[model samples]
Target: MKKSLPAIAPGLPLGLLLGLSTAAPRAFAQEAAAPALEAAASLNAGDTAWMLTSTMLVILMVIPGLALFYGGLVRSKNMLSVLAQVFTIFALITVLWAIYGFSLTFGGTGLFYGGFDKLFLAGITPDTLSATLGTIPEYVFVAFQSTFAAITVALIVGAFAERMKFSAVMIFSVLWFTLSYIPMAHMVWGGGLLAEDGALDFAGGTVVHINAAVAGLVGAIMVGKRIGFGKEAMPPHSLTLTMVGASLLWVGWFGFNAGSAGAANGIAGLAFINTILATGAATVAWLVAEGLHKGKASMLGAASGAVAGLVTITPAAGLVGPMGSIAMGVIAGPLCLWGVSGLKRLLKADDVCDVFGIHGVGGILGAILTGVFCAASLGGVEPEGFSMAAQVWVQCKSVLITVVWCAVASFLCFKVADLLVGLRVSEEDERRGLDIAVHGERAYVS
Candidate 1:
């Protein structure tokens, strides 16, 4: 019998040689694929510490800033009710974020929502590093983002304040956070589809501001007009409370715009300066509009102007120079004032506290202006192939997408909540106000 040897495949020798030849390159590539957990060059340890502090500062914005902002805008009878709504919602968002919101917003590998591997914060520990944060603790990043979620939900209350049922508000908030907010957040920030397309949001123009504004508008409509709306003379019960809240928001906003840089660097510094200038310019611009149109600037107008400035500068804060921020502020002030006053009347939407006016309009303006003002010379990171016009078109696309997504989600949420638990307070609750009717507590004991 002939000695038979298993014949080697024709390509086996070549494959073996090729595999051996490429092994080192593959190993090298593997070694290179691991990301550094820290920055290439960290400057001041103090700077990092300050950023951590600022992150906490922003937490104050929604927990109290937004709570009191909406609280003081409603009637005195509904004051505590609104306050209750804000407080409870803040706590709810905090818990939900710990459970799933953070994962949904920041989890890996999804177009509209994040993955669930990090659900309930599993595997996240004191040492877990944030890939985007570069050595910053993942816990720190989560805490910072939690505040944004809290505020975004709180902002919607302004649209249906004093009229919405407490139970309904609670239910809808939890639902909408899961359904609308988290998905949009993933799309915008969490390495999702929009980010892959090179959209520059810097902060949360579409995610937070526009998201809340659109939801608020839809809730206002679906819940239907308040009993005395349009034909009534409803005024903010306490301008003093509104002023305090606005002031806190102004102070806390430093953290918001700057901390968005995710590092304590030159860009953060520039963002800080722009936030201040833009807010001041907008306040003055608002007063001017009120004086010219109404013969006197209202305190409410001033507060709204401050908010508008904050909203307008959010997207461009890291991208625009101080001058660009000031320009945006000047424009946002009057334009928002007009929208809040006469524009609501023209549209007849009964947006209770001008959510669409301040946030929606401001978000749009800031997003578009970001395209014009983003320059490498102005603390901006210019992406490859991104031009001003291209960026503007991209921003518009983002706005339109946000509007449609938010509109549908909000409408559906409101409708469902309405049918299940009812969106509006009873008519008796409306005339007597929600504090006594809904919460069964009077804001004033005296």
Candidate 2:
């Protein structure tokens, strides 16, 4: 039999075999490249317009909406400081996002950090399609995410309002946004650890709300109580303005939640309805709880409840059905009230605007409940292999990761700002208010 076998050609060398394996795919890829490019070129105009509008709405949230909301909550003496901080943070974060923030958050495929391949947006052209939402141009996605980054930083200003130096605020924002926000965004949205773990954060309960809340709490504690721990009146100067600001926030949130669907389609419409239902339900629940606790519900309670509802629904807007959204709102209203009252006292941090109380507590609740609600048994569009217990665990892990990272990074940022420019204004400046001392102008003249 051995003698009868025919002679055989020698097998190709190992290097040749490896090269053939790799080069064959590369050749096929080159052949198919034109079709991929053509597919990417077929951009949807409607999606582009919606994303652009969403970006504008989120910008409005930070500027007059958040600014006026926080401004009304502080004493009239410090009103200008709150407004100035919000406006300036928006401008600064926007610039940073264009330069390096977007690239670092969305460029690479690393677990904890992203690469600088798109540094200074060097490779992005008008024709380039987004990696995530391919129907829109990459530029529109950049602009949309920029607004989110701006609002996240702006939200933190509420916690340390009325006392920190403007210089300190500026410095702390840069550091925290760079260290805390970028990494969190990567983990949740940029194909990092959290995203890889199958953690579901539809619209950033962990990234936006919890991250900002923890940072705010840390800053408040580090800056110390605002001169008079528990002794002063410290009432909101204008609930009228507060109501208007809250109203603006509610309107703009439609874009914030629904627009996260990245298309002008059924999911976006569903998110829109959920946002409305949840916000309205939260408002009612807040009033009811207030009546039970204090015997009379104030307009302020309604406004705060609405905002809390908005926060609670942020993670679930596109994930859960209408009933689940309402349930979240109802749960969040009373829970957040307790957070502002009981948890606030327990922590003893001077979170001036209750940033941690409402946003933080509501965000956590929404995130965890989102996992439970997004089940086939609960009316959500569940996946084939969805497990409620598994998803809930993943959400908890995501929340824990965000809290620890933000807490530690923000503490370091505050320390650095303290070393560089100092954190708190003088006691005299605190009494006079940052509006006068820092800006050389008063919010209201007698």
* Top candidate, metric TM-score: 2
lDDT, model 2: 0.82
Question: What lDDT score is found at residue 398 in candidate 2?
Answer: 84
Across residues 79-194, which tens digit of lDDT does each residue of candidate 1 receive? 99878988898889989999998888777657888888889998887766554454356777788788888888988988988788898999899889988898877777775656
Q: What lDDT would candidate 1 get against the real structure?
A: 0.76
> So what's the TM-score on candidate 1?
0.89
Runs of candidate 1 exceeding 4 Å displacement: 1-48, 376-381
> Candidate 1 — worst ten consecutive residues by lDDT sum?
3-12
Best-fitting candidate, measured by lDDT? Answer: 2
RMSD of each: 11.8, 10.7
> What is the number of backbone collisions in each predicted candidate, taken in the order shown?
0, 0
